[model samples]
Target: MTIRRLPQQVADAIAAGEVVERPASALKELIENALDAGSGRLGIEVRGAGRTLIRVVDDGAGIPAEELELAFQRHATSKVRSLADLEAISSLGFRGEALASLAAVADVECRSRGRRIRLLAGEVVESAAAVPVPGTVLEVRDLFANTPARLRFLKSDATELAACLKVVQAYSLLYPEVRFEYTNEGRVGLRTLGRGDATAAAAAVLGTAVAAELLPVEGEGIRGLTSQPRLHRGSRDSLLLAVNRRPIASRALGYAVEECYLGQLERGRYPIAVLELTVPPGELDVNVHPAKREVRFRDERVVFGRLQRAIRAALNGSQPYRMAEALSSAGSAWRTPQVHSAPAFAGLESVVAEAFPAAPGAEGPLRPLGQVQDAYLVAESGEGIVLVDQHAAHERVLYNRFLAQLRAGAGASQALLLPETVELEPAQTAAASDHRDWLAALGFELEEFGPQTVKLRAAPLATPAARAREALSELLQTLAHSLPQAALANAAASLACHSAVRFGDRLEPVEQRRLLEELEQAEESITCPHGRPTRLLLDWSQLKRHFRRNY
Candidate 1:
């Protein structure tokens, strides 16, 4: 066989494969085009999970009647003309291949003011005059229809719809001044205000409940929203990040956000945020990927440090953190796990009831005075004072018990009146399936209810009914992102954190004493499962030194 040049249609379809990986990919391109045209209002409608149809109507500058046909040609663009223009590319869709690629594999109908251009297999087959508008109404139908192989790669309606909604939500944060509406199968999923209030838009996109808990963060060139420790998720699914009002994926930015929440939130849980960084166009490169989702920065370390410091300030100012609460005696940082030789009660063959052995005194080491902020238990000791983290103390106690029960192959399983159901993501669902027996061994009686949902009939740990759903979900998410050996510790830590006493809860004197007793009994009473100090000790000598007292 002799080598020959491929047809233009074949090349266009191949390019389409790069930009139109899925429905969300095409939707993102259309959105960028709409934004570049200065659309104040963007309306989107999807059918059959965006495989059958995706229509976008924008109120921006429309194409001229004569240029409608030329718009679909390969490499045709008005955004950039020379190589120098690529350095300072400001527009989102400057590559100009998105439209051509989308048109190559799908039936495209473009409607402008008094003109309609239709394409079939990347060719302009029909051009006619239509009713006029100031913007563009682009309709893409039968996506991957010409390429049946690509059509087969589509996922379930729910999953694909989630993906498309994620794109819309991200862009909504990028341009709060643009009124955005998304309708799936004629049902409106999201609608945002266009008054340039990012807060209101945030509340509309991420439910008013979560939006209310977001902390405002601002730095030299970065400004956006971040969630308080209480308003976090099992995964970074809702972390919306953008640069210059264009949503992009940057691992550095994601890590910077998480680093701010380091000791505040438990392991495996991520904070909710929409961080928008404003950088000079020349300092950033957006041409890394065909979809333009990834970007490169010139001074990443400096920018990352700025983002880290800004978010850390916001988190620190929001409330008193666990580390700060215990820092009086536990040193400047959280407890380090290496301080313990091994798990105090490693194999759990035989249990030690007195985990925190009593000293030679009737009142013992801790004498309860009262609660501080309704969170920590203030106690009097031979030392100046002891501030006991009620949540951390309870967490330490429960973790040892849960792990011991796991070693015993079965702990006391507490059944719920109504079987609680939790819906997992696709990846989590797969992880749960792979480790079903391991979870069962850890005292969880879970069964697959549906493709992506699980039913929890019984739990080993004494978790509340209201928290059972979230507790199990976070545990699975922890296991989903860990290795086999380390995953067990992550799971145990998650269970303890979720089942332990929460901050801001009122505790009676008797309950407080019981918690102290149980916590003392744990082998590793110094630190919680995740290496947070359970109590801080301030001796009399240290207290006296502050007052300049010499004895």
Candidate 2:
């Protein structure tokens, strides 16, 4: 067959395949267009998961009446006049194929009031159109209508709607000054008025729970906040990336974020973070993909170095917030609280009862030595006196029990008689929708109300109601960008910790006895879930050496 030019409609449809994967892709394109057009406020409305109808309204400088027809024409763009301009391209939507491709498979109506001309331009181009408006109003109906195969692959309405919100949220974080509002299925979802600070914007979108743990990051010309190492979830779902005010999913950046948290967090745990880098347009390539998700930096090392340093700074600056509580009563009678708080027991009966509850097949009964200090319970065995960290042992026992329950699929759920409704930013709502099943498995039943709200029906009864709500919000926010299974597990562990007894919580004699008994029956009562040592052992010889008695 002779080589001939492909038909325009065929070519446009083919191009659409690259940029328009689903309703969310089209929404992303339109959002970028709006941002490039200098919109400060944008509103999105979707019906039938953006398949039947999708509309984006922006208060940006609109297109001219005369150029309205040309806007949808293939390869026509105001972003570039020559091929050389590609090297220094800075605009978000520059390819000019977005509208043309969208028009091929859907009924697209674009109305624009030119930046120079205030009047609306009305025209029924090859795609679709009705009356025009003052600014830019793009309405796409019957998406993939022309292409039955593409429509066949479309997901459920809820899923697609969530995807669209995710796209919008990505842009929202990049452009802190741009206010965004989203409505889906006749319900108001997310409404974020532009705030100058990205952290403030993230809090508005991700929720205060996640925002609270985020340490402010600033260093090496890169600035952002990273979640504390202890708060790490199991995945990268919480990582958000932006380059010069544009959200791009660069793998290099993702690695950089992970590298920054190395050694600070446990092996399987990953931190939640939003990293924004400012590089010269000439030093980066934003036109790497049709979807514009990836970018190539001229100096990847610099980018990586900056990212690592910034995160390290943030983590080092902020420490976990601990609540003040009353000390043990025994400590008050001592000359100093520190001395009495040391690992020592007052009574041999208490020590023997707490540390060595009759071991199976033991030859003889064990005797207890007096407390080493207030911290450790010292017991006399044939070998020597064994010192035990009571607090660490209890933590290990609790952690093991929780892990066993989780592994056995017997994790308990305590239902709230009254359901709690949380108002989420668009991104968080999307994130929640994506992980609804995971959350359910962890004993949370949640339903999406709109683009910005979730209805939480049931939660674990043992968990505090307020902490549950906060944990859910934070987990969703952190996992918005990257949702890996490991991240989910870490998040679940955090939730468990919130409900578990703290280190300093005063235990009654009966409570302490019960806890120790339970610990004796638990497997792996030596380390916490996060790998922190649960139990510490010190012998009499070591103690005597510290006091110069052995010497």
Candidate 3:
């Protein structure tokens, strides 16, 4: 076959693939254009998860009547002029491919300054006079309609809508002065005051309670709101980053923020941060990615170090993280304990024996010696010494038991002495409502208390009161922002992780022995549900070699 150039329609469709990967991506591009057009107030409406409709109305400079048609042409943008201008591009959008991209894959209509233009798959379908509007009113319908393969790849409506809402939330925080009202299926998902206060915007985006606990960050070139060490989430979704008011996703930046929280948060947990950095445009490169959601800095090391120290300084100036606060935050019972001596060895041995009423052959091979740093359980075995991760072992046991209960449809639920109320984020609220029945199967009895709030009357058997609350919160967060296809297993694992004995929990001799027996009975005891090892066995030979006792 001879070499040939692709048709214009085909080329435009291919180009649109990069910019409009999903409903969320399209929304992001539209928002950036509106922001660049000097919009102070924006209204976003979505239906059918942005597949059927996505209407963005902005109170910005509207396109001229004659230029409305030109705006839909490929490579048409007002943000940049020449190649030299790309080096100092301060606007969020410069490529000018958003309109053309939308017109390629979706039916796009734009009404500005009494002129309306419509396109179907990059072809001009309609151009006529319309009602005058204050700013640009752009509507994208039937997204991916022309691309059947792309439409087939979209996720569930709940998942897609959540992604769209997340994009809006990020922008709301990135530009607090821009008032935003977001509606999904006629229900208001978010509304920000946009008074130019980051904390106030945070209150509107991330719940008022969370906003109230955020600490002010004042770095040399970094500023925003960050959560106290006690306030954290199961995922890094809450870590928002913006350089010069342009929101970009950077795992390195996220790590820089989290490094400052080293030894401050538990494993598998991250803090809520909204960091905005002031970097000169000349030192930043935003044209690397087609979507402009990624960028490169001249010196990532300098930025990383500066961000880390600034966050550290902000954290240091605040009161040190309190042990009680950390414990109380997770619903664990971490209070002053009454001092007591260890029970008699014989009594504990008898209790352990009774608890594990199995055949003599089923007895655990390891013998509990004591604990280390009130964390690890040290035990003696025929070969040598074994150090058991008490938490991991307990997690393994609980996960198996929970999975069995779920499969058997007989999950044991314990009634709480006092009902607890939990207020969730917008996405979590939607997730809880969507997966209410699944949560019930996981031994949670929740009632709708109010908007974004739930009343918990019961939890999984043996789960502590506060711990159950924490588990529910984490589960909802995971369900909302994580792998929905594998949610059931993840839910069980989350429950197990929360209900298991904490690392710092001091277990009595009998308790340790009983745990060991149960672990032995578990079908899989080598690793916990999350794949962490439960025990580390140091054989006699290895120990002797380390001690220079080869003989």
lDDT of 3 by residue, 288-402 (tens): 9898879999999899988988898887676422211221133211111122332344352332222211211122388889988877888776655666789988988898887
Specify the highest-TM-score model's number.
1
Error of 1 at 117 (Å): 0.5
Q: Given candidate 1, what's the lDDT at residue 145?
A: 89
Clashes of each: 2, 22, 1
The candidate 3 region of ten consecutive residues with least summed lDDT is 327-336
lDDT, model 2, position 459: 77
Candidate 3 is scored at a TM of 0.61
TM-score per candidate: 0.63, 0.59, 0.61
Say which prediction, candidate 1 or candidate 3, comes out ahead on lDDT.
Answer: 3
Task: Report the candidate with higher TM-score, 2 versus 3.
Answer: 3
The residue ranges of model 1 lying beyond 4 angstroms of the native Cα positions read 320-551
Quantify all predictions' global Cα lDDT against the true fold. Answer: 0.77, 0.66, 0.81
Which segments of model 2 are wrong by more than 4 Å?
Answer: 1-4, 114-133, 321-551
